[model samples]
Structures are given as C-alpha cells and as structure tokens.
Target: MAHRKVGFGLRGIGHAVVNGVGRLGYASRFFLMILIGSGASFRRIHLTIREIYFTGVMSLIIILVSGLFVGMVLGLQGYETLQKYGSESALGSLVALSLVRELGPVLAALLFASRAGSAITAEIGLMKATEQIAAMEMMAVDPISRVVAPRFWAGVTSMPLLAAMFSAVGVFGGYLVGVVFIGVDVGSFWSQMEAAVDFRQDIVNGVIKSVVFGIAVTAIALFEGYDAPPTAEGVSHATTRTVVTSALVVLGLDFILTVFMFRGV
Candidate 1:
C-alpha cells in the first residue's frame, strides 16, 4: 500500500509537469502566430484603431481617477513619514520615485488587465462559442490576423501611453497635496523631483515595464479566449482567468524586469 501511494504521487507530479509544459508550448505557438500575422493585420489599420479605442480609450477614465487618488495618498504618506525626520520637503522625490519607478506601470497594467483584458477574453470566447471563429476559418479569414493580432497590438500600443498619462496625473495629484495643501515648497517639490528622477533611468525604465506588461497581459487574454471551451460557462471562465492570469504575469514580470533594470541601484 505504501509503495502504491508513493508511485501514485510521483505519477501525479509527472502529469502536472507535462501539462504545464504543454500549455507553455501552446501559448508560445499562439504568440508566434500573432507576430507573423501582425504585418498583414496592419493593413487593416482601421480595425486596429477601433480596438485601440475599445481597449485603451475605454480604460482611461478609471486609470486617471485611480492615479490621482493614489498620488494624493502617496503625498500624504510621504509627508507624514518625512516630517518625523524633518525631510518633508523631499516629498516630491518620494512621490515621483514611487510612481515613476513602480506604481505607474504596475497599477496601470493591473487596471488594464481587469478592464480591457477581461473584455477581450470574453469577446473572443463568445465568438468561439457562437461558431463565429469557425465561420471565419471556413471563409479562409485568418482569425489570428483579423481578430487577435489587432487587439494584441492595440493593447501593446495603449499601455505605454496609459502609463505615461497615469504618471503625469499622479504627479499633479501629488503636487496638489504636498505643495498646495501641506505647504511643501512648490519650487522644491518640482525641482527636487526633477533632480532625483532621471528621464533615462526612471521614466524610460517605467515605459519599458509598461510595454512588457501590455504584451504579457494582452497575450494571456487572447490565449485564454482562444483556448476556452465553446460554451457560455467557458466564456465566463476565460474572462475571469484573463484577469487573474494577467495580474500574476504583470507582477512576476515586473519583479524580473526590476531585477535586471535596477540590479545595483
């Protein structure tokens, strides 16, 4: 009995490993197909643009609102913490560094995943469930080019702009709290932030992070939707999975990228 139990456990582990590797391979193939089809999809720029409006424009309000509130909170927290050390004036550097280096990209991506990513997944999953994708395939229309690639590229393009907007709005929100409300010197607030936050080191790296996150989140959304079972329950599950998986991927990728981008610093 003991030997049988041990063998069963080992078999389960082996099966899990194989399943994980198979999923990875499948996702990789899907990604490659998107890349290859992107050129042809570009000619249908109008479709991509419509998707951008859906994915990017639709998410802007929430992103901006969240950014503003987050910045204000950071400013308040930074001021209170720095006051103990008589360094309240450094609030600008604190807020700027926090947002530009981490919050801007991570939070924006999270919001994007929850909003646009889930929508994309559900939309595609429903199409699959309704036999729309099958019809397209039968008509010799490449769904990868017609459906997936455009959405993927739109997301990739939208993320950096959204991150930039988030950072900009966050800075303004911080300024309102620190400089106007709390009486931190306005000049010092802006100047200190400018001095400490290098465009190349902080801003550029943040943009890079957002771009990577965009790709990961969008790719997962498309993959889940494409792989979902052909049923209403499957569409719902895929949508939920998109949000959960995208969030995890964004966070994990952020950690890996941060390690490489700011290793010594």
Candidate 2:
C-alpha cells in the first residue's frame, strides 16, 4: 500500500510538471514564430483578412448587445449603492472607470473565445482529421503560414478593436441608465466621468490587454487543433480544450493587467 501511494504521488507530480512545461514551450514557440516572421506568405495575409472580417467584425453585434446590458446593470447597481451613501453623482465615473479599465477587455475576450476560438479550433481540427493539413504538407506547403498565421493575426488585430467597441457601447448604456432611467443630469454625468477617468492610461491598458488576450487565445486554439489526434473524439476534445483554456488565459491576463495598471493607484 505504501509503495503504491508513493508511486501514484510521483506520477501525479510528473504529469503536472510535464503539462506546465508543455504550455510554456507552446507559448514560446508561438511568439517566436511571430517574431522571426517564420511564415510570411501572400496566401496567409489574404486568409487572415477573411478571418478578421469573420471573427472580429462579425462578432461585433453580439459583443455590443452584451456590453450594453452589462453597462446598464453596472450603472443601476452602482447608482443604488451610491444612493445609499448619497454619492449618486459619482455613477458616471464609476461606470466609465469599470468599463474602460477592466470589464470591456475581459468581457470582449470571453465573447471572442466563445465565438472565434471555438470556430478556429473546430475548423483546424477538422482539417487535421480529414487529412487536409497532411495533403497540404505533401504539396510542399507550409501549414503554419497557410493555416495558423491568419487566425493568429486576426485574433490579435480584432481584440483591441472589439474592446474599444465594447467600451463605447457600455458607456452609452450607462448614459441611458443614468439619464433616462435614473433621472440623473446628463451634463453632470459626463462632466464627472471626464474628470474622474484618465483616458490615456485606463483606456490604453484595456486595449493593450485585449491584444495580449487575442494572442493567447489564437495560439492556444491553433496549438491544440494542430496537435489533435487523428480521430473524431480528438477533434471534440480539442474544441473543448480551446474554449476552456482561452477563457482561463483571458481571466489570468486580466488579473495581471489589473495589477500592473493599478499597482500604485
């Protein structure tokens, strides 16, 4: 019994270490490819533009609607709390700060992970299983450039734009709640918000975080999809892993950005 327990413990530790190292190695290689321009092809750029249009722009409607509701809820809740403290005038600043500094990027990343990450994973996994990737390689084509580069750049490029859109819609939502629903003065709300929030740092941080998240999501999805086993079950597993891992990475990056942005504030 003692020997068996010792062996199990050792095996578990080894598994954990291996998984950690693998993830780190994957991230390093993905970044290195981008840095070294390992796969620069005209076909890749065209495909990437198509993907950007689909994954980024096509996703705007859902993101906007979701942002509107989130902002409305935040304003409503913040108003109620501030009312209790007789600081109702602070609602605009609160909403703007929250949306521009954190919620906008994080929420958009989550939405993108669900919409784009899953699609990329499924598409690539299908290609892998159907032997399309193999066929391309057999034709002396670089699959990374043809397949992965476009999706990776699309994600990185779209994330910041999506974050900005989310912020704009969220601000409008808060405006509606404050002026129409809560009967707060429009001028006062805007003035207070402008006074309280620093657009340079706060908004910039949000946009930067979105780009980083994009890179993480696209890389994870592509890596998992490319490495998927040659089976239907493997494709399904890759899809799930892509979504879950992207979501976790988005949240983790959010935390890191928050810490760095507000470290001394």
Candidate 3:
C-alpha cells in the first residue's frame, strides 16, 4: 500500500509539473499575440490614449498620496537610524537611494498591480463573460487588436511615468521631514544624495525595473482575463488572481533584477 501511494504521489507531482509548463507555454503564445495585435493601438493612437486615461490618469491620486506617506515614513525612520550613528546628514542619501533604487519601483508596481492591473483583468473578463469579445469576433473584428492591445500598450507607457512620479514625490516628502521637521543640514542632505546616487546605475536601472514590471503585470492581467471562464465567478477570481500574481511576480523580478543590476557594485 505504501509503495502504491508513493507511485501515486510521484505521478501527481509529474502531472503538476507538466500542467504548469503547459500553462506557461500558452501564456507565452498569448503574449506574442498581444504584441502582434498591438499595431492597431499604435496606428490608431486614440484607443491607447483612452486606455491611458483609465489606467494612468485615474490612478494618479492614489499613487501621489502613497508616495508622499511612504517618503515621510522613510525620512523619519532613516533619520532616527542615522542619528544613532551620528550620520544624520546621510539621511538624504538613505531616503533617496531607498526610493529610487528599490522601494520606488517595487512599491509603485505593487500599487499599480492592485489598482490598474485588477481593473484590466476585471474589464476584459467581463467583456468575455458578457459575450462582447465574441460579438466582436463574429463581426470579423480582431478583438485582441481592438480591445487588448491598446490596454497593454497603455500600461507599458504609464508604468514608467507613475514610478517616476512616485520617486519624485517621495524625495520631496523626505526633504520635508528631514530638513523642515528634523532640521537636518539642507546642503549636506542634497550633496550627499548627489554624490551617492549614480545616474546610470541607480536611476536608469530603476526606470528599467518599472518598465519590465509594467510588462509583466499587464501581460499577466490581460492573459488571466482572456483565459477566464465565461462566468461572473470566473471574472471575479481572475481579478483577484491579477493582483496576487502581479505582486508575487513583481517581488520575484525585483530580487532577480537587483542581483543582476547591483551585483559587484
């Protein structure tokens, strides 16, 4: 009986592995389809612009508020820590580096995933559930070219800008807490940050992270929606999956990218 149980367990494991691989393969093909269909978004431009209004503009208030609060917290905590070592002036470097190099990209992406990513999945999934996508198909309209591609491109475009704004606001918040509230030396704060932060290594890499994160989150969201079962329950589950999957992927990618980008530096 034990031997038979072990065999069953092994078979189950193998089946799971194969199932995961097959899903990955399907998702990859879907990503390519989105890429090919993306031409309509670029050619028309208005469709993509409309998507941007939803995914980007509608998301700005949350992004702005979150960035400010995060920066203030960082400035306070960083100041306290640096003060213990009599390095309070380095607070600016600590805050700036924290935001630009890691927190800014990671947190911004997380917020984007929860907010915009979930919305994309829910919208597309609803369209599927309601037979809108099928209606488009019946009409000889390429639904992907018309529907999915614009949102995909809009997400890719908006992520970098949102990340930049997050980092920028965070820096200002840090300055407020450290300089105005705590009375840190203004000159030392800015100078230390300038000296420590490398444009190419830190700033550019952060932007790259934002872009990659954007692609990953948007692709996952669109795929989940497209693959969702045509039901209300399916759409809801897909929306939940979009946020959860995007968060996990963002964190994993952040670790991998950090190792590659910051290793040996």
Candidate 4:
C-alpha cells in the first residue's frame, strides 16, 4: 500500500508538470496569433476604445490613492533618516528617484494585475467554460480579434497612463509630507529634485516599463482564462493562477528592467 501511494504521488506530480508546460505553450501560441491579428483588424477601433474605458480609466481611483499613501510614507521615512546625516535637502531627489525608478511602475503594475488581470481571466474563463468562445467560432467570428485584441491594446495603452498617474501622485504626496509635515523648504525641495534627476530618461524608462508590464499582464490573464478546464472550478483556478503568475512576472520583469536601465551607471 505504501509503495503504491508513493508511485501515485509521483505520477500526479509528473502529470501536473506536463499539463503546466502544455498550458504555457498554448498560451504562447495564442498570444502570437492575437498579436498578428490585432494589426489586421483595424476596424475594431470602437471595441478597443470601450475596453480602454472600462479597464484603464475605471481603475484610476485605487492606483492614485495607493500611490499617494506610499509616497507620503517614503518621504516621511526618508526625510527622518536623512536628517541625521544632514542630507534632508536631498529629500526631493530621493522621492523622485523612488517614484521614477521603482515605486511608480511597480505599484501600478501590481494594482493593474490585481484589478484588471483577475477580471479578464475570470471573464475569459467563464466564456470558455460556457462554450461561448466556441459559439463565436461557429458563427465565423474570430474570438481573438473580438476578445483578445481589445484587451491587449487596453492593457498596453493603460499601463503608461497609470504609471504616469502613480508617479505624479507619488511626487505630490512626497511634496505634501515634506513641506506641510516635515517642515522642508518648498523651493529647496523643488530645486533639489530638478538638479538631481533627468526627466527625459526617467520618464521614458518608466513609460516603456509600463507598456511591457501591461502586455505581460494581459497576455497571462488571457492565456490562463482561454485555456481553463471545462468546469466552474477550472475558471476559479484560472483566475487565481492569473493573479499569482502575473504578479510574479511583473516583479521579475521589473528586476530585469532595472538591471538593464542601471547596469553601468
């Protein structure tokens, strides 16, 4: 009995590994197809706009509020620590660096994954489970063009906007804490930020990172959802996997981007 149980467990593990790899392969191929088809379906502008309105603009409140608090905390902590070393005047530079280089993009991606990724995963999974995708196929409608394209564009377009909002709010939050609570000189703070950071490279890097993160999130969510097993339980599993996997991918990508952006300097 013990031997049989052990063998069964090993078989289960192997099965899971194989299934996981197969799902990943399917997702990769599906993403490529969608990417190709997206360009060909130029007449779907209205659908794309609707997707942007729903997925991007609707998620603004959470990103802005979270960013504000994060910046306030970072500024307060950084200011207090720097005060001991007489570097408090560098608070603006510190805040700007944190926002532009790390916090802004990372936080926005996390929020986007949680808010938009899960929704897309669940929606697609449900459609798959209910055979809605099949019905669309039967009706001669390409689901990739109708479903995946809009989401892909929405994710890519929204990411930059969300990242910009995060960076702006974070900087404003830091300024509020520095001036109103920490007693920092407003002019000195602004001067330090202006002198220390290059807006061009920082902004460009942030926007680029946002676009990458958006694509990743949408791709992962759609892949998980479209490949979900044919059951309600499968839909739930897909949603969970979408959130977890997207979050991990975002973090991993952030590290890669950071290394590339700051490799020599």
Among these predictions, the greatest lDDT belongs to 3
**lDDT tens digits, residue span 46-127, model 2:** 7878989888988999999999999999889989899899888888999999999889998998898888888888899999
The positional error of residue 215 in candidate 3, measured at the CA in angstroms, is: 0.4
For model 4, the stretches where C-alpha displacement exceeds 4 angstroms are 1-13
* Candidate 4 positional error at 256, Å: 1.4
Per-residue lDDT of candidate 4, residues 1-265 (tens digit):
9999999999999999998898778888998988887963458588888888878998899999998998899899999999999989899999988898888998899899989889988988999888999999999988998888888888888988999899899999999999888799898899999887776677788888888998999899888888889799999998999889998999999999989987877
Better of 1 and 2 by TM-score: 1
> Which regions of candidate 3 fall more than 4 Å away from where they truly are?
1-8
Go through the candidates in order and give the clash count of each.
0, 0, 0, 0
TM-score of 2: 0.93
Clashing pairs in model 1?
none
On TM-score, the stronger of 1 and 4 is 1
lDDT of 1 at 220: 98
The global Cα lDDT (0 to 1) of model 2 is 0.86
Model 1 sits at a Cα RMSD from the real structure of: 1.1
Which 10-residue window in model 3 sums to the lowest lDDT?
56-65
